[model samples]
Target: MIEESEKGWLLDNGLVAYALRVGEDGVLEHLHFGGSLGSLAGFSAWPRQAYRSLQIDDRGKPFRHLGTLAQELPFFGRGDFRSPAIAAPGLDELVFESARKIEGGLDLGDLPSARFEGAETLQIRTVSRHMGLEVVLSLTLWPGHPVLARTVTVRNISDRPHLLDRASSLSIDLPQADRHIVHLTGSWAREMHLQRHRIETGRFSFGSCRGTSSAQHPPFIALTDTDTTELHGEVLGGALVYSGNHETVVEKDEFGAVRLQMGLPGGMRWPLAPGEAFIAPQALLLHTDRGLGGMSHGWHDFVRERLLPERREPYRPVYLNTWESAYFEVDEDKVEKLARAAKKLGCEMLVLDDGWFKGRRDDHTSLGDWQADPKRFSRGMGELARRVTAEGLKFGLWFEPEMVSRESDLYREHPDWIIGADRDRPGEGRNQLTLDLSRPEVEAHIESVVASMLREADISYVKWDMNRFVSDLDDAKRAHLYMLALYRIVRKLRKAFPGVVFENCASGGNRFDFGMLCLFDQTWTSDLCDPEGRLDIQSGASHFFPLSALASYIGPSPNHQNGRISSFEARRDVAFFCGSRGFSLSAEELEAHASSVKETAGLYTSTQSLVTKGRFDRLRTGAEIIWQLTSPSGDEVVILYARKRSEPNPPFASVRLRNLEKGSAYRMEGSGELWRAESLMVAGLPMPHTDHRANPPLMKALPTGDMATALLRLRRV
Candidate 1:
């Protein structure tokens, strides 16, 4: 709810509060953004003192107003040394011209953004008449969520056109400084590694210029105090709902105040014609005084409830993917054998990874051709799909719809469909080029090809893959337009194939963002499936995304990627916490571990409710990691994993569980031991001293080895 007062505007969403006011010179000033503020009565009295201390000099002379003022929508050329949220060539300066409240949330044409349902919105319009541009800032607050969604729209109001250099979806000023900045950064095989640093006096930022949301930096940023931890201190987090080139900036001014800005990266100048408008990406802001974990829970709930598609609560299927199992050697007979083995081990689906298309023997060719290869499958794709389904398993296919191999027939026929400069040939990655989805003809061709495949076969799932990054686009706007067109295609495909589940992958988690998450059921966490590396990868991803949106599968023991041999128990334990569980092993390979595979499948079936729908908590100290999932009604389960061997005289450490009802007695699933939640939380459960002998039993003590993992289940009594 938004309430107006003599001081400024106060927006509340039951869990968090946002307040701002107009300064004497008509500038929209930021006041407070954090925990809930009960009433607006004392809010007005605090801004004056806060601004004065942050601005005034010791000699009683006031510094430049632009440098001191914490404007909500700051512009360039206004003496403000900080980065401008919106910048244009001629009209780099802007002032607050008008402000008012609005009814529905703003729209971004065909782009995917967070929808505000039954929420209050405030629209503040600022104009630079000399430059003939008008900027509209909309801030929306939902009823029960602590998140605020912000978007900016720029209109060329004058008779001439305007070139937009930079425009951000959201920007805010924090009154204090010396806060810690936390973000995710990594590369292809290893993605989303959490890194924290102290906010210094200069600018610190990270972004993607590779066209796709590159793994170099994810679209997430957070600020917290030095004392912040998983369960304590205040944290403010923001993420963009964009999968294209984006930037997040943190600037600390001379006065020790900090400004956080997130928007489209510079260098792409969008030409806005007279009366036409350009809408920036949406930025979702979350605030929590209960620390990083609280912020994570809020983001998880927001994504699952608001960002994902409708009816997203259904159980995610456990399947077997043929990527690592078969790779480019997959054929009708091989897939049939894998499907039968998958069914024997309780897999509900079988996904033919790649090399199923015509003339496709390797990744170097046959990406655009969506038909089954007659040489490999003489019986036809429809027959193979039916045979797989007859074995009581759903059939899925892999497609790199956005890419085409130069060796493929489609690329030879339609070379104009690729995004490239007229003068220069585009550089190739993975022996492929990107299809220009921004073009209507290209989009239509992809839609028809994919639609025909789904129609020809009884396919129930698709592993959508984009193997290479986009490059050599002549137009600067092509990157943004590409993302817009991709969203449109995915939206139409979902409508056409409502029953088919889509898993988004870009050589593993490169395109991981809220925008794609809204269109697909889950994402491939990473291409590197070594159980050891995945522990960190999944942990960093879970900070912003829910476990249900992450896909974890047990791959070969001597992992195909890194050749790191891991125990089946370690791999299965880690995969169980992921939302969509699967295996990447062949039928012949599965026989050696058939009993273990069956036991793990049974465990996944029994714990599906807890892992998918329950709240998740993490407890980590050094090489030991513990993840807990608790239902809303208090049933809980925990997974403990130790990466390294213990010391010669290891200290006895207890693992404490979180999110349990205190004073309530809970029964352990295997041992039938009853313990009060209060005692369990306070004293923690002791690590077992010896290995257990049961088939699927909990560990008696912390296992010591290169790879070790244990599972514990509990129910309130």
Candidate 2:
């Protein structure tokens, strides 16, 4: 570790900077910076690998391709700037230069380095000084692990009081190329673009969506389905530019590095007064591999691995979801219809969704009443469970157990059961209040619901939905406590229903982070199910999650969230990325596309062991196309590829089966007959590239199209 002087001369670029001692192990472990007083570069040492250059300004223009890079930079601070060329000291120096004086003042005098009692934190400090604000970037490594994290703390230490922006900037890499930036915030991004390496930059446009925070706060950007390669190593730097008013651009470096840039309100615009500081909570993890492969391996080995990872056992079977059909209103008949459809389609379980309780309709009311809705099912809820069992399908039920509807019996009796400031003023969202699971009574209520459903209905699956975010930030206790409550609930539920599967949903994908994967068997990837959208959705989700515990449930085309239609085969191909699969479409709608849907379903089911249980090898996704290959039994292999746009000549994607014993005989169904490993061992096997435009061809015998029922039978030597 090294420390440097606070006072320093400005470089030619109008940036005052200092160097830190670089690590030899390839992990950039520590950083030492100063504001010209003295050399603080020796404060500490850091892993070189921990930091990367996030150059957001591809063309050095003030606003071109701004939002695309904004999504990557995590923490950004706002301060006064009149043609200010303020430079951040991360990612090879991604600078927010030449910006008009925004409306905030910053001070760095009282800024100090933070240290934890334990060395396990791998904590290091990053200091950046501008005219009015001093920004400190601290990274805490996960004890002894290679993964480093980012935490930004800004203080108002200036004598004259000034305001600051709420958001901070973070820069990482994006390996995917040529994908649209879909900002989750409500405010539209002005200009966005992508510039790869020394290559020229292109104009970038963002998808429309609402911001996750108030206008003054930095909005969260959700960049859905993007190829991993483009956002990988080289794409690791960018900036967050903001006006005190609207618009935030996550400018990326010219070299395609990942970065995040956000706007902050003036000090008066904040919820706090001057002299007080604000901190942005964010993190980053760098695994050896990229996308799903990297995430799956990293998560399993480092974090929790038992959350329904890929299993070859028959216990891991195809399932069906009843949510898309019933929504909130469900009963015996609706449940039965879904169960029968699932059974007919070789599904092992049927998950009954919301509105199965009394006084529940749409998303407005009812959740505490775990009891079945007698009105919807004349024969009663028990009868529905029995009917599902009789139809040879295990039964499951949906519950937003962590929430209470405003009109429900739970909230009606104990108004304090929800998280809020006052019983008179309940924090309402989605017409509901987030359950104060911290309360013993609330925990018991959830436990009883799970127990009763299992005992009464013989249910074997549960799809838990936390549709809304936790509001009433005034009660700061819930941030940490709420998460603990979630963990406890999942722990208890797993203990009681040992064999039951729980699918995690945070209004679909918001909660899809490392913390929750420890509990749920699978996570709903996204609310958008359009096949095209899902391609990037899956890719983005896999950026930090395992493909095994990920669910790619095929929601109907012209999806409920996004009204877009995709072919059944395209949907199937998208779903195959991870193992656990199901359908979220109506039986009626599925019936309309019956033949193609059935064919796609059969293709997934037949080769599922290979798809789910196999070792994954990502083939391509670095350019205009994406593809991956997996081997189930270690003998047989399957490859799937999709081209974003039609190419002059569709290139043949090659695959190498892992863990295959030499001298084994493998059979390619479409290729006919069988071939020995010795033959391919000497000369590698070539995978065919066939047009799967119509329906997938069923290659039963061999030597033709890989087909719908494409079987690649193999035998050990």
Candidate 3:
């Protein structure tokens, strides 16, 4: 135990700020403050027992009495002072250590050596009220790394037990927050009105998150008036509040941003027994200035160029998959047959989905063996890869690297490898255990597996799948630490297979977020492949993505995830309008719809640039309508019109096309209708107006003008 005076720190405001060398760099590593002290007991920080012995009082004060643990701090004075003559500097560089407390008084614990030896400082402060607490804290800049972090600390200075009725409050500064886009839990928040005084809130709905405004009128604010039960169908709690003026913004002008965490420390039923404390994690990210202009416009540009730069221009996957059509009885012959068919159909790639491993007929076993199953491919993966490449198509494979079936050799060898409360507790996700990425052995195994497969075959694409979420994370209490370990694993895989394209698929889009996107090139948007179902998913995703980065691969009409039969025209329109467009249907299914399939393929190739790499514009949408997407150059515009029910199109449904140069020469290709750029820009389009309003119940809004609308607009010098 150390004293405040000895530690050279002070506690004043409703927050804490400190200065210390966190790691290799002399950068200020971390700063922590705020949250009721009682909640700190629930956390699992370093020197576990060090905090266990401290005493806390009814006023939420922390103190230490003697050698042994106590429920209350020994009384000193009205305003007592304590300090150690000699102590550790840069304590935050590593774990908390038991050093020569000013006077060599108490033992902290066996702490690791600090990574950096530098002057360090600590401070804790806060202002608390019955309702909640307000906090503002800062730590000196260390300049060690691109970002800095701090561990939450709770000291119990009091003797009585307390119950915290609420969660703690954490806030982070968004210096670039003004320009950069931010997406939290499936909704995007744009800068609406940044005022001088108070932080006003705005709303963005889930399915309607693309443009500056959401489809819903009341709009979707990051935080709500009350606890929201409709957030992605989960009873989610918490609100996102903002402060600072919009006019005086920070963008390429700022260097770093501050982050804050405000929430009730867990187990807040503060019956916080005297000697306990709780701590939570603070997650943040700092980025370079690209398109900070909300909706990830600038961010996506960077992502395409930096994060996923292996492929030349976005390689929209025109793929042939074996999941739905071929489940268990897939063999070399079947794969070759499919690849040939896929090539004939002009598909760019061929993917062997599952059941191509030794002793792996079912989902119950053989995940550890990444090698091709002899029975499925007698010639092996290398031979198969060469054959596929010979047919002028790329080869892709699937792997659930994070999971292991109980019957598998890996799990049988190391039963303890799976994460669980105890050895007896059953693991989850198809009776499998999550490979602990924290374990160096697990990470090495993943690396070995990836290396072996990449080396064995001429594989160009990989669909990385994580089928489930973690429930019991016992290795450590801090969830972010575990997440950090997982991220490291991804980095290892990516570093090893730099040439192989990796697609993130978390049981089909449940874990879809910017964090994951930052690592993998493309993400399987959703398992929901029905064209209609995808509209919602794609709309929500496009809020913060470039259409080129989105994996808009078309699957079978009656998708495995959702049973909805949609026309090939609609599917191609939606899929090609985004990044990669492909199909997962069987050769027979596609062959049966031969003419339509060919047309769809041709359409994708014709408008690949406009759809995959074009500037987007939201035309119009409301309760039961949506018409959007246009090219950067005014050459073409792809529009879709749909009605809620088969209702007569009401009056005039006007959609204003954006990004048109007013004074340029323009001509509509369909009717050979020559119109000036100014005229088209002003009048917009009265699409299908005649057929839409003919009858009330039978009337439907359909796309007009041409199968493909191309308008030539001359660029102004």
* Ranking of predictions according to lDDT: 1, 2, 3
Task: Count steric clashes of candidate 1.
Answer: 2
Ranking by TM-score: 1, 3, 2
Pick the winner on lDDT between candidates 1 and 2.
Answer: 1
- lDDT winner: 1
Q: Measured by TM-score, how close is model 2 to the native structure?
A: 0.59
Model 1, CA-based lDDT: 0.82
Per-residue error at 311 for model 3, in Å?
5.5
Q: How does model 2 fare in lDDT?
A: 0.48
Q: For model 3, how does the per-residue alpha-carbon lDDT over 163-216 read when each residue is reduced to its tens digit? A: 433222222222212222223233212111111111222211121111111112
Model 2: per-residue Cα lDDT over 1-717, one tens digit each: 112234211111111122323222111211322122134434332221222234243245433223232222232322111111123222122222111111112221221111222212212223232333444444333333323334455545444444443434233334324433433221111111122222224323221111112211222333323444522321121112111122234333444533333332212133224466555433333333233344334433333222232223523356777777667756666677777777776677777777778878877777676666668876766788888889997877778887788777877888777777365575567787787766777777887877777777777777787766666643333343444555677767777777777777656664554335545667666666666666656654443344665676777766676676555666676776765777777879767866766666676677665654555444445332244444644556555555444344456544444435566777765535566766644554444344445223433211222112122345443
The C-alpha RMSD in Å for every predicted model, in order, reads 2.9, 11.9, 14.2
Output the lDDT of residue 561, model 1.
84
Which candidate tops TM-score?
1
* Cα TM-score per model: 0.95, 0.59, 0.62
Q: Write the per-residue lDDT of candidate 1 for residues 1-717, one digit (tens) a residue.
A: 888887778888679988887776666788888888877886543544334445433224355356666778787675565788888888655657777776758767887877667878988888887888899888899887889988999999999988998888879988865699999999888998999989988899898878878788989988999899999999999999989888999998776889999989975689999999999988989999888898889999988888877764557777888988888998877888898899989888888988888999887898888889999998888999999999998888889999999898998898888878354778999999999888988888888889898999999988899988888874668888888888988889999999998889999989899888888888988998887888888888989999878888899979888889888888887888788888888777788889988888877777777776789887774577777778867866564545554455555556777877877988887788888998888888655542343223443554656767677677888
